[model samples]
Target: MKIGIEGQRLFRKNKHGMDFVTLELIHGLQQIDRRNEYVIFIQPDSDICIEEIANFKIQAFSSLAYPAWEQWALPRIAAKERVDILHCTSNTAPIWSSIPQILTLHDVIFLEKPQTTGSSKNWYQRFGNQYRKAIVPTVAQRCQMIITVSNYEREQILKTLPLPQGKLKVVYNGVSRRFKQIQNKRELINIKEKYRLPKKFILFLGNTDLKKNLKGVLLAYSIFVENSETVIQLVIVDLKQKYLSEVLKELNLPGLQEHIVLPGYIPNRDLPAVYNLSDLFLYPSLRESFGLPVLEAMACGVPVIASNTSSMPEVAGDAALLVDPKDALLLANDIGAMLSHNNLRQRMIRKGFRQAERFSWQNTAEQVLQIYENTSKSRVTRMAA
Candidate 1:
């Protein structure tokens, strides 16, 4: 079977959740399957991370616009290659493609209420969300199968879209093998000095997205610092300084800036060390399809504090302290307790390691391969009939 995967943003230098998911899926497939022919479709990027394997090929297409690239260039190329099934790893797919499509709809956050209006989101975010809002439903209706990361996200998709029950599949995302406890003392020290990390700190992988609950985290951290006697700091990764300044001003906690560390973007290879160096991982997102960082942190043997809402509880399970994301005082108290109590922290660490062990990229890829095969067979059957 010739399986085509739309990995548009896979080669970008600074990848996000969906990009990493797609890349890992491809890697997993490469490791396990050698019988079927696979083609990865991606936009031209400076970072050439993925290498061509036997039975797998990487095809780069260039376009100034994302929609034009996916909608026009993608379909034409897929047809030219005679792809049996095209699996779009990201949220959206080519609407006009005749080949049976398997779409990985990571989340239906765009379809949810309280949608971000003008000025609420930056131009790129606003454009991407709007594009998804416009194209996803139509693509979802037309696609042969829809894949989501978590059961919670599946339910959310069902509530928002009228797709049939049989068409949706829940395939949990996996943490990279690299995210584990780092034992090399010298390497750890080097990474610590490089990032200028605090001696003891809480790690929150923050971004400009509203759903990340950055403002809420800032408020909770302020409350924690004001009440607690500990000298712990909050280390935030991937957040821009300009946005951090705005958030600080909005929360009226400009004085708390000294306690916060913004080390900018840390590469994926260095993340395990960052997790191991941290005292705790805080991921109090208001909404998420699947909180991959929560699992990554847990895999690194770091105790976590995540929100009770959305897919987080499902993902974190009994491993981490689940708190209401909106309740700042509650989150602050939990952070303090986790910091001060040795037994509680140790117990969480043990549970987290066990939980993280449950997910693997190899498993995810095998399940996805089954979907592709089934979809391909069905298409053949339809043509015969």
Candidate 2:
């Protein structure tokens, strides 16, 4: 099979859940499907991060056009490459491309709730919304097959568009095995020294989107500081310091200084150590499709306390301490409980590893291959008839 996998997501830095889903899935695809002729379509200046994967080929398109290029230029190149299929790892796909596509929809947060309406609104315009409006539903309807990270997201797609039940496929996101099996002690010390991290700290990673419920995290952290005897610091990684400071003021945290730490975007390679060194992982997101860090924390054997909404309950399973994102008290209490109880923390680690085991890129890719073959055969049978 000649496949062209989109390489844009790997270039996205300081990205949260969906980006990781895309990057890791590409790695997994290469690992499992080496027999297939694969060509990764990257924008210029990608630098080819993963040198170890020798099975496939890497080619570049114009980085300047970037986002719009996927729809504009990549499709023509994909046809030239004679790609039997185009797996759009990112949600965006070419509207006019006749090539069969395997488009991955990580979540439908924007379509379900236009986040830019209320006080939660971040900016006047978000990237790719305009492109995605035409790209997503069109691909969901027009593509040979659709891939969603969660069953919850699949159901949401059904609600959003009238794609048939058989058209969609569910492939859970994978946790890097390194996260589950790592000796980050030296690295953790290095991270602490490098970042000047606190001794006892709560951790939150990823973008501070409206659904991420960072406001709830800040409020709960404030309550934790107020009620707990010990001073537990809260460290948020991968958001703009300016944005975080504004969030602090927004949540009235400037007055409560020294409780919060806003260190901007850490490299993905460095996150395992960060997860290992932390006291607990608090994810108070309003909703998440897969909840990547929750799995990352579990893989690092760190106990997790996450919001009980969206696919989180399904993703976290029994591995995490679920809390109501809106309830500051519940969030704070759960955070404290995870910190205080060693046995409970250990139990979470075991459960988390088990949950993390249930997903792997290899398994996900194999399932996708099956879907491709099934979809391809279906199209052929219909065409012949």
Candidate 3:
């Protein structure tokens, strides 16, 4: 079978969760089915960057508009390639296509939490009822198969949309092996100096966007530090400047300013060391399909404290402490408990390692490949019948 994958996110230098997802899927595909042909569909400019990316053919297109490419150009390209199946790591597999299609919907965050991003907010603000009336039903009726990152998200998909249960698949994500425990003492020292690391710091790794629950994290940190000032520090990375400024102003904090570190956008290569050097990982996001950072932290032997809602508890398992994201006081108390109680911290660390081992990109890929084979055979059987 000929498999085509969406590879646009490769254009980004600092790839996020989706980019990693696409890359790992390809890696697994090549290992599982070397004899079967693979075609990676990339953006035109990204072609040069991904020339060495895979041992497969690449179909490239150049376009700045995301929705336009998916709506208009993608199906034409898929048909031209005579692809047997097209798996979209991103959402929406061209409104129409001759080839069988599989869509990887990261989350229906746009559907569930419309205010989370600018476009969704605009769509809802301008045409709230009409947009939902038009798009939601269209997707439920037309799409062949649905893929989500976690059981939590799969449940959401099933609940919100009227679709057959068989079409939905839950394939968990894997943390890159590169994000393992830090070993190099000199590298750790250099990273500490570079990012101005604190002696004992609890770390949060997400953008400054409000939905990531940055404000809540800051309030919790403030409360935690006020009660026990000298125990550990708080590091906030990848926050937008505007949000950072607002958070600082609201804090109106004094010497606590020194304790709060905002080191912007750490390189992916350095994440392992960053996780290793920190005391704890805190992810207070109000939304997530699967919290990849939580898994990455566990791999690095870092104990985590995450929100109890959405997909977090599912991702965290029993490894890390889970707290209500809305309650700043409860969040603060969880951080305090992790920091002060030596026995609790030790137990979480051991549990985290075991939890991290449960997921693997290789396993996910193998499962997907089996689906492709089954899908192809079913098509053949239908023709025969």
Candidate 4:
């Protein structure tokens, strides 16, 4: 079958969760399926990471805006290429397309009520959420199949939208091979020097999003620091210093910045070293479809402390210590406990390794390929009828 995969943000320099998922999917498919012809659709940008293989093609289409690119240009191009099935890896897809489309709706957090005040402060994020709100329901109704990341998110989607019984599929995300525990002393030292990381630190991959529970983390960390005998640093990635300063001001803990390290954006390739050098990893998000970072840290042999709500419990299993994200004191206490007890920390680390092994990108790709073939066959049968 001729397959078209929408990977519009694959070429961007700073890729987020969905972008990485799409990139891994393409890599997985390339490794396994050489017989089926594949076409990848992306918007032209920097960081040209993907290369064309024997049976795969990379097509770049430039547009002034994201909505214009997806809604107007994408379908027209896919139809012109005569693609048998077009898979939109992101949440939104072109609604008017006739080419049997499969949408990977990672989560429906946009449709639910906003959890925290000022969560959507970033203009781009706010616009994207609004666009998904307007686009996803219609696309979900028209698409051939809908793929979500976790069972908790699947139920969330069903509670909000009325999808058919068999339309939604749950395929878990995988930890990249690069995230495994690194033992090279020199390599670890290099990453530490590059990021100006302290000897002992707790890693929190935080940003400006309110759902990330940044406020809660800061409150918890402050409590942890005040109570602990040893001084430890907090390493936060992809967070701007200016916004963090503002948050510190609001929280009335201006002095807390001294213990916090803002290393900005670290490339995916360099993350494993950072994870390995850290004492603990924090994933205290208010909600998540699939908490990918939790597994990434676990794969690096770092113990984790994550929120108890949403799909976190399911994804984290019994590997990481789970606590209420809203209660700052509870999260703080767990952080101290995880750091203090050697036996408990080592036991959790072993369980984390086992949990992280449960998911793989190859398995995800195989399931997606099956869906494509089934979709193609069903389309042909309908045309014959």
Candidate 5:
């Protein structure tokens, strides 16, 4: 069967969760399945990460606009290639594809009721969310199969949308093997110098998304520092100083300005070192379908302090200290205990490794491949009938 995979942002340099998941799926498929013909559809990208292998081919298709690129150009190309099954890896997919489609609806958070307070999203993010809101329902209803990252997200989708039973499946995301503990002291020092990281710091991968709960983290950090004498810094990745200033101002924690470190954007290759060098990893997001960073930190042998809400508890599984995302005092207490208790930290580290081992890209790919085969066969049976 000819399988067409929509990997729109896979070739981008700094890939996020969905992009990394799609890329890893493709890589895993390449390693496992060589007989089936595969065509990867993508927009124009400077990075060009994926290479052509035996049964896999990369095709670049572009349009002037993002929506048109997916809705118009993508369907046209997939139909032209006569792909047996088109798997849209990202949350959104073409609404009018002639071929059988499998959409990976990562989350339906956009469909939730808008918060009373204004959103923290910038113009681009707002536009994307609007587009998803407009298109996801129609496309989801029309698609042959729906793939969600976690059971939590699957339940959310079913609750919000009118979909038939057995239509949606949960395939958990996996962490790469590269995210292990880095023991080389010299290499660690070089990475620390490169990012200007403090000797001992807590890591929080922050962003502009409201659900990331950056302000909550900052407030929690402030509380932790106020109660403790140790001068531990908070290293934030992927957030700008201007945004940090705004968050600090809103939290009324001007004193935390000196204790925060902003390393703009760290590449995926350097993340393992960052994880290893940190005392603890904080992922206190308000909601997530599957929190990848929690697993990544665990794989790196770092103790994690994550939110107890959403899929975090499901993912962390007692491997990390879980606290309420909104409760700053509770998060601060957990952080203090994690930092001070040596035996607890050691136990968490060992459990984290075991938790990380439960997930693998190979297993994810195998499950997806089975879905492809099943969908293809079912389509054929329908056509015959």
Candidate 6:
């Protein structure tokens, strides 16, 4: 089968969750399936991480904008390449494409009401949300199959979009092997020195997104600091200092900034080390389809404290402490408890390792490949009939 995978942002440096998911999916497919021909369509950029192999080929397309690229360029290329299936890895896909398109609609968060208005998110985020909100429903209708990461997201999609019963598929996201516990003292020290990390800290991977609940995390950390006898720093990755300052002022926790460490964007390769160094990991998002970071942290042998809402409990699955994201006091108390109790922390770490072992890219890839094969066979059978 000739498969065209939409990996528009794959080649870019500093990838986010969706980009890593797509990248890992491609790598998994590459390792498992050599008979099936694959074409990975991506917007031209510098990262060039994936190399062309025997069955897998990298195809780059240059376009002025994301919508134009997906709408105009991607479909034309896929048709020209005569791909049997075009899998849009991201949430949005080409609406006009006649190809048997498969869309990985990560979540329908964009379609929901704005969690925060005004400057919570920048112009780029606002525009992207609006674009997805407009296009996802139409694209979801046209696509051959809609793949969501978690069961919670599957229900959300079912409720939000009017679709046939079997049109949607649920495939769990996998944690990469890179996120294993770091044993080497030298490597940990290098990463620590590289980021100038604190001696001890709680890690919260967040951005300016309102759903990330950065404000709540900051407030909770403030509460944790105020209540606890020992002061442990909070390390937040990929957040801008200027934005952090603004948020600090807004929360009236200007003193909180000193207690917080912003090491900016840590590369994906180095994340495992950061996870190892962290005393505890926080994933208190308001909502998530699949909390990849939760698993990633767990894989690195860190006890996690995640929000109880949405798919978090589904993903966490008793391996991590779950608390309501909205309740800053509760979150802070949990953080304190998790830190103070050695036995509880050790139990969580052990459970986390077991939980992380359950999900793997190979399994995810196999499931996806099965879907592709089924779709192809069904198409051929229809034609024969």
Q: Which candidate comes out best when scored by lDDT?
A: 4
- The residue pairs in collision within model 6 are 238-264
RMSD of 5: 1.2
Q: TM-scores for all candidates?
A: 0.98, 0.92, 0.89, 0.98, 0.98, 0.98
Query: The CA-based lDDT of model 4 is what?
Result: 0.93
Clash pairs (backbone) in predicted model 5: none
State model 3's lDDT.
Answer: 0.78
Instruction: Output the lDDT of residue 380, model 3.
Output: 84
**Model 4 Cα lDDT, one tens digit per residue, 203-272:** 9999887889899999999999999898689999999999999999999999999999999999888999
Clashes of 4: 0
Colliding pairs, model 3: 44-61, 208-239
Q: lDDT of candidate 5 vs native?
A: 0.91
lDDT of 3 by residue, 144-175 (tens): 67778999998888877778999888888886
- Candidate 1 lowest-lDDT run of ten: 113-122
Better of 2 and 5 by TM-score: 5
- The clash tally of candidate 3 reads 2
lDDT of 1 by residue, 146-259 (tens): 999999999999999999999999999998899999889999999999999989899999888888889889999999999987669999999888889888998899999899
> Global lDDT of each model?
0.92, 0.76, 0.78, 0.93, 0.91, 0.92
TM-score of 2: 0.92
Compare candidates 2 and 3 on TM-score and give the better one: 2
Q: Weakest 10 consecutive residues, lDDT, candidate 3?
A: 117-126
| Model 2 spans > 4 angstroms off | 12-15, 52-55, 115-125, 382-385
Estimate, for each residue in 26-127, the C-alpha lDDT of model 2 and write its tens digit.
677777776778788877554346443666777776746555688788899999998888888777788888788878877666566564212244443255
Better of 1 and 3 by TM-score: 1
Q: Note the clash tally of each candidate.
A: 0, 0, 2, 0, 0, 1
lDDT for model 2 comes to: 0.76
**Candidate 6 lDDT by residue in tens digits, 1-385:** 8999999998898899999999999999999999999999999898898999999998898999999999999999999999999999989998898799899999998877664322346888888988998899999999888899999999989988999969999999998999998889999999999999999999999899878889999998889889888899999999999999998999999988888889999989999999999999999998889999999999999999998999999999999999988999999999999999999999999999999999999999999999999889888997899
Candidate 5: stretches off by over 4 Å:
116-118
